[model samples]
Target: MEDSKKIIIVGAGLCGSLLALRLVQRGFKVELFEKRPDMRRKELDAGRSINLALSSRGLWALDRVGLKDRVLETCIPMKGRLVHPIDGDAFLSPYSGRADDHINSVSRPGLNALLLDVAELNDDIQIRFECSVQKVNLEQARVEGFDHKNNCSFSSQGAIVIGTDGAGSVVRRTLMARTPELLFNYSQDFLRHGYKELSILPDSNGGFKIAKNALHIWPRGHFMIIALPNLDASFTLTMFHPYESEIGFNNLKTKEQLKAFFEKYYADLLPYIPHYQEEYFSNPVGNLGTIKCYPWQAYGKCLIMGDASHAIVPFYGQGMNASFEDVREFDELMDVHGDDWDKLFTSFQDKRHKNTNAIADLAIDNFYEMRDRVDDIDFKEKRKLEMHLEQNYKEYYSKYSMVTFRPELPYEKAMILGRKQDEILLNMVRDKSQVVNVDRVLTKIKELHENMRNEI
Candidate 1:
């Protein structure tokens, strides 16, 4: 590896660290920069996304780095959702018909620290924390920034620059600034709903307060609260609510209002999270938004990936998984277009843009389903029918299964076929009065898939 063949990555988060390791494995030198103090040296935010859902796509990326088994040792397996209704006992809805197909809850800081540790051990990788990137010359792969630690300015030009800097990326901003030449297109849609962090402490025995392996949900019509298990036996609870309504974040400003609202909607969950009132008032509310942009690559010398290019709502739990998949895909492309930075950047953008867009839309659609339809009669029936199909037929996968468990399938294709299958299944369950035939449903789906493939 030489300076002339170096790659500059702006953002030493999960995506950037993973990308640096993969690039170094392929014999390219890397210079990694981050705007914040290194978390391994200092403490991280206490109330931020402490844990994330890790599924097949993210696992595939981790396996490529030979860290999958090590990471899995730290995760808590979540088999399904335990739905708690307003007036009835709780019930479980399996994520998939297959027993082994499930997601894992892993701590965000734990995983990032591992990634940074491995990246630092590589001889060809150099990491610069506490450096803020101010400007980028896209065509020349140059970066100018301030070093917060040393109080100095520096600039460097590498062979290529990749932005894994997240939703408000400075590298992406440079692309926006040269919009006329790049013909860049961008759109951001913010949800009326926002989220605040809450928590459920472990029992006196230092065990879980509820079922340890399931994600629990309390889905009220307009808003909801969900919990994910942590390695410490406690659970991280998140309240997703609107901005200004009766039970919204703004209106429930006092302890009395919050306690009453919980009594009305989330009564069963209140006992487990006795400290909710304190956490709710102290934690900050975070926005839920989607950011989509075009021309991810400008002049083939600079490119944006991960949340920097396609930031999505978190309802689908695919935000981190999707970014991990980006590293996997980009690493594979180096084999096809070796040493041609322009061709490699072009292929990466063309391959990922549509699939990321599909996941973005799917995540948004899931927000409504999680809030309003998970406990509905028809939606329940639809899920039951889907489970039957998956159990009896190995080839069948629900939309959630396609997105979560099938790493070989592109998300755009999964979205298209899954949407069609959902429509047919819902119609059959609603419009018919007889027992559903699993064989007939499978046959119909295969026939329709063949027709769609031929048309494409």
Candidate 2:
């Protein structure tokens, strides 16, 4: 009976589906429940999925699941950020000095659907679409919810329950309900800024309106708009702005006002988006928030993973990548502890919580950097110095490179080293009176990493 017990996974989205496939591959039965209609058959969520930037960490996870090549076949690679400033000529900010170290732009719904499809191929995994799991009895490993179609409740018990239900997670809610007993620590920080999805249609010949290989950024001081390429030749644009400022989402209600605002800030962007007014009025503004919680595993029988355990803002483009990496990390723990859910869950969370928290903080830091710091004189010099170091020195990886390209390094360590490197580089770049030495800068970075202890 113990061996026959199934593993229940909540929310059959990206993380849940990939996780289910991995579980089944290890000869475990998985019941994956999703609340929404299967997107493979239905239309995607209207106007809000900013195209996901799939990088090394995410690719490593997919590779383990045997989907890396399949996924990559459909993804368009973005080499760097092309920053569009309001005052002058736009310039490209390379994500890395190396061309091979690029990020892929993948459709969120498309990727999720692919995961669901692959997950369903295995008989050991049973994915029920339109069924929502609202509560989990942590002690007993039981889940209770309904098939939203008929409004009928159902319950099941598993060897363990995994919550990958994302930001507003019901599994996480259950853990919160047991705060007194679990002493569960939790916090949510919502950004003052929010984002509304818009678009840049392809040219008449179905070609990309802008450079397809670059992630386009119209960076304003307080807010910014970002665009990523899609396979359809069109670009998925997200307008991230504050809710209460002069260029706030709440203030622009009419066409005239919206037109005036765009003309002032995004004049160059107008040619690509003739339907801006229509999309602006139609799409909803999504909130940007980070959710962090402690003791991701509950009672050795239930655990939370991905966005359910640690939700972060989309600024750093690591939300999905981090979630994918969660599966790889969990799988590694399973390799060591085989079939012992208790040890696996505890070990998994213990190693992961700090890393997740680091990325959350890093995402917030990137928000400000992208919004206000990208075009600064010192910042440009810093980037130029970093590019030179990266090209010549194989040992050197800028902060973004360390986090995005290095799958072997943990997020916590990457953040610690990256921040220190940034501070040093910034100081050096700011004081242009002295000549900069790439070898010396790399030596300092190496020393910092070597001297670092495991603070996480």
Candidate 3:
């Protein structure tokens, strides 16, 4: 008889839970371990945080597991970015060419709850909340961790232990010790920016003070504040600024200093935020981290996915989306390998490492573009060239359309193509002599697309 195959997944966050669901659906016995108490047992305070932008990449993964429609029930779609310029009214900026194309904001804990519920229905999956891995025996394919009672330590042997754990992952550390060479090429940059959340309470008439279908951005040169809609007709606003900014909450400790900073920087939106002073001063600061790693899976017996593999900066609004994509890519590899555990895992790592790295860089680059360059005239001109490329080479070339709208292309390939396109467009824009010739650029864009297609 074939041996009973088992997989241990650490960290029951979004990606971990989804991985459990997918594995169980394929008839594999799966054990999910989480360090946190069951989230449902306690109130997840809004003071901590709320939603994430559920983009196409994220939605596709959920849909594969039959969870998308349910997730959509709680999501509020952000049709376009509402940029709050320094002097003018906020204007809508479309990312995918069409105004209707959008990413949705859904509560993080809410989505977690849904995934957990579905996972519970899988008899093949055993979820152990409040259980932490104390040690991992990579040679033996086993995990030693504390149980829920926190008294006796227990050891469990599985075919492989996959670390879906977050950035500071114990499993990852264990993997590092056992197989130092497999240690991914990793780097992290903590942007000077930090974030604090504030709420816009629903109006007395139960109406939203801001547009419910928009991701609002107040872009100042060194900082930005973005607000995404919630189901309760309220918006969750996040204030992001350089750690060294004189107006940061740390420096503006007094109410007078805080108020003066807000008045000068975010005057129009301040009144909409209830208890702005209290929330701003009292809320904990959220840090932005960009992480890149390689070789996500070890053979077919062990693997890492999601944040454990790539923790990206949130500026691109893609941390969760990329994690979800990791799940889908693994699943696809499983299909290609015909459920051969070893082959499936080997293929997964080979296929997904570059994709994850590409998104990490994309996320970092977007930080600069969003906060400092989005409104620059030169940048806008380049964006215009991108539009021309998309229109003229609809079949061969696309920038936002492919990255944001198409899920067929791997993340790494999309980034590669995007960089190539960016280089071409930058050159076109740098030539002031050709600035007035739109038709000439269109011809160049088509030729570039043909050359790119042939090379691919």
Candidate 4:
């Protein structure tokens, strides 16, 4: 018999779209709704991050939907971070020792459009665009929303509601309202810094203005500008700056002030973006914050996923990847508990929240690492040692590699082991008297991993 229990998903972005496709594959009818008009049809406002780093975890989820190879065709391989210091020559920091292990720079809309197209192919999925969800009936699995196109309000109910809405999720708001009864715990912590998107347009011949294969970062002490390559040959540049300081986004009110600030701090980057001032003034400043909450599922009738549940700062380039991982993990849970919504929802929220929390904390840790410590002598030495360890030992995976490249490893396990490995490696690099011994370091790491595994 066809599964009569319909899965209603709100927010037809990356997670929602993918989840809808997956649910259809599992023989469930899916009602996918989006607040915005379909990107495949209309040109929406350029959202927060134009491009995202798609790593192994995200690729794994795409593969589940048989869209991985197709998605890969649209992505530019970012082999590693190309660090450009203000005063020194630029350097390449390889993400991993393994040549095949690298992240891809994929346009957000391009990928989302592709996913939506694939989701639409399935007859079991019905997608509604421009359907802004106003309120959700948590216990009843019903959503009431305003339909912008029809200029009317509509209501729909499902066997269960799965919310894949982004950070500012209306579905999540509904859960918050019923917090006292559900014992829901939520916290949103914003970074002191915010980001503004700028661009380095393609060269005269429509060629890349900078290295097209690596993520470029011009890290300043208190702020940074990072650029990711687009298939169109232009680089999407983001300026992550404080909101209040003299050189901050808040303080750079006038064109002249922004020009002077760029000329002083980002002089090297100014050439690539001749229209920096215009782009800076034109783009909107986006806030960077982490959202954490408990009891992702309410009564096994409603659940929240993606940024809607665990939004994190973008420093680690894992927000989208983590959301994608959620789909993959949830799908795995479905395999075990087929249409048992109660067990599936309970087990998934209980198991996945810790892993999401680990990545949230790690993303914040990377904010400091990317902006303040990427150029530090100690950090450089530590990375060098990590690279060497990864190259020599087949068993060794750096913290970055474990998180970015190892899709099989849970984020919580990766965070724990990777942090321990990082401390050991950093301490090893700090000892000037000791010769850099690869075998000894590997032994120590192996022992540490073994101990951690046993303890856990």
Candidate 5:
């Protein structure tokens, strides 16, 4: 392939920076445009979800760029979710088989900066900050943007324009406007629930108040609190609650109401958050929404990826993972088609649209499972058996293992395969049939496992 093709990438966020690096590596000239200032120089806004859980799908992409070790340097590995029971002792359950079945906890801005730095290192990729994408002109294959300081509009023509822009993507909006009948469906469902971040500052001894190597969840049915570790030995705690509850922060105007609410509902978290009073009042509430769209590409000259294509709730922590996978897939398709823009993009959209929608749906469904059902007696028993199946069957069976630890299987196929296996196990439990032996189940799972491995 020639090294002269020029590409304009909008939004130098995680997905955008990664795609730029990959494209540059393939001998394409790339320019990255970002609306925000140099994130490396600025701190993330206080109330935003400052960090996220990075799993296999995301790590695999970094590995492709030869940056896995460098990225891991800033991460704290969490072995599993530490479930805090309302009336009993907290229990930590591993997501994968071995003690090392873990996910990395790292700051969003930190990861983004690392990716941007790597992108900049490549002479082929030129990054422009404070450049807001205003529109995409598909006819001319160019991107129009506004300079923040000069208030002047600028334009760049490219072989192709990729919108790694976020949910409110100008590129996507422009693409849809140009092709209204492209089988695109767009919707955003705002959850009645909202989230706010509170910090568990490091103790005097410079250690975490709770386990640093675990994701702590204070699941209280209608509302829950989760804390993820930071490299600074502090924990970023998020409170997810209904927008309007009897004793929520919604209607509480006085400190008395605030104290009463915290003492009653979030008592488990109060001790760890010593400055809760101040944080509770100051932190801005973040609205939760699920964004869905179809046919993520328009003409050969333009396409959409990441949250711009399918933004889901953060419960499954798969948003970043899915977006990273998109970058990898797009890069591979471009590689296979030898820069035949139309052929490569058509193939990418056909394969990626279904995969993105499936994961987006799963992310939405996971919210209820985390908030309302993780602690249910029957659900817990089933999950325990599911974990056992992952170990016993080893080759054919897995629950959390496939979702978090493996990126080889497509998200939709993994979901379908898991449900079928769970249904078989659930039937056995319902009938209390010991004759429905574990060995028999393992035998059945082995065949399915073989199929799954091959399909991926």
Candidate 6:
């Protein structure tokens, strides 16, 4: 096929690669650039997110590129969250009441490599590695960057330039440079807490030491550790804790302090991770933050998507899924606008800005919920009622389900409706005198949703 228009996509990560593949499929020549070496040819660095939860939103995007089934083949189904309380035995909490609803645990690099492979299959898509984007000419749709391997600078122009370069995107920086003209709005809020990746090695018999088909969480009052299974029967554990408290990352510097802390808090998990001390000291503590910005498009010639525009905390496990959804949404916009870059870019940003912002806020809300409230009695009661509602009524959807499973619902709508439902459910569960009637709860929720719909 002959290509008349070209798209310059910055960053060949999950979002960029998927976008490149879809654009090439749509008959536009795609030039995809990545700063790092080709991951397919090199081992990825440790300490980054090695695995991710692949849910409905992400799978919808994969399906658009004909890679859904292949990707699913590489994932392990995580049916629910296994919550381990400090004072009680571990228990499972299903993600959804519907039997078929569950998330998948897939390696981050594995999925990226698969998308890169699919992107490379298209003759119209050109992927360059070790090429760092230095600047973007917003008006001209031109990108200037240094080619590390070639030891020189390079420049390219496209009909439209899309930035998927992640949170520290140079494309986004270019927009910030012209902030006054674009009326750009930007804010980055970091959490006092940070995370470090640890691992639970596969057992001697090559079997999982913990529940294989669940996301395991050990939630403390102010800190927590969560693990997701890998296809190799291993689990990648992340410690989400503060950096300055008495039991924080700053104070647990010595091997003795680490061991003693684990013995006191994560005693059960301590036996599973034998080299906890070594791993703790070797790994880097990554900061958590949410990045939000406006005017994702500049002069309708350049646009930013994924983490480049809205980077959120990883508490809700929706970061990658949200990025993938960006691609799917952008593709939908293209279906209407075709190669009219100006209209397409403008509409895409306008439609997506609020949705991304909604998810960003929801993710932050989930940070506290995951680390502090997951094991609380009131929270547990609310969840139990939510599960019952979901099981009994086909129309009932929890906030988690709406965000995770309902791809048709926008994040903004989900957040608005789900928050109302949460308040009502929590109130009913809190009242000991009220006999929680399923029918009554369902009717009230439906009425609340209708009122919200009318107000909107």
lDDT of 4: 0.90
Can you give the lDDT of residue 127 in candidate 6?
A: 91
lDDT of each: 0.90, 0.90, 0.79, 0.90, 0.80, 0.90
Q: Model 6 residue 404 lDDT? A: 97
What tens-digit string does per-residue lDDT give for candidate 5 at 135-198? 7887566888898867788778888888989888998888677555676677788888889888
lDDT per residue as tens, model 1, 1-456: 238679999999889999998888888899999999999898868635588899999999999989999999999999999898787788899999998989999998989999999888989998999999999988789999999999999888899999999999999999999999899999999999999888888899999989999988899988999999998888888889999889888899889888898888888887888888888888989999999999899877999999999999999999999999999999889889987988998888899999999999999999999889889988999899888888988778899999999989999988998899899888877776877776777788778777787532
- Model 2: residues >4 Å from true position, as ranges? 1-4, 47-50, 432-443, 446-450, 453-456
User: Global CA lDDT of candidate 3, please?
Assistant: 0.79
Model 1: lowest-lDDT 10 consecutive positions: 447-456
Candidate 1: where is the Cα deviation over 4 Å?
47-49, 432-440, 453-456
Indicate the worst ten consecutive residues by lDDT in candidate 3: 389-398
- On the 0 to 100 scale, the lDDT of residue 41 in model 1 is 90
- TM-score for candidate 6, please give it: 0.97
Residue pairs with clashing backbones, model 1: none
For all predicted structures, in order, the TM-scores are 0.97, 0.96, 0.92, 0.97, 0.93, 0.97
In angstroms, give how far residue 278 of model 1 lies from its true place.
1.4
Can you tell me which runs of candidate 5 are displaced by over 4 Å?
1-4, 47-49, 247-249, 429-456
Candidate 4 stretches greater than 4 Å from native: 1-4, 46-49, 433-435
After TM-score superposition, what is the CA distance of residue 405 in candidate 6 from its true location, in Å? Answer: 0.7
Model 3, span 356-453: residue lDDT tens: 77787888888787777777767777876666555555563455556677778877778877777777677777878865466766676667667778
What lDDT score is found at residue 194 in candidate 6? 92
What lDDT does candidate 3 reach at residue 246?
86
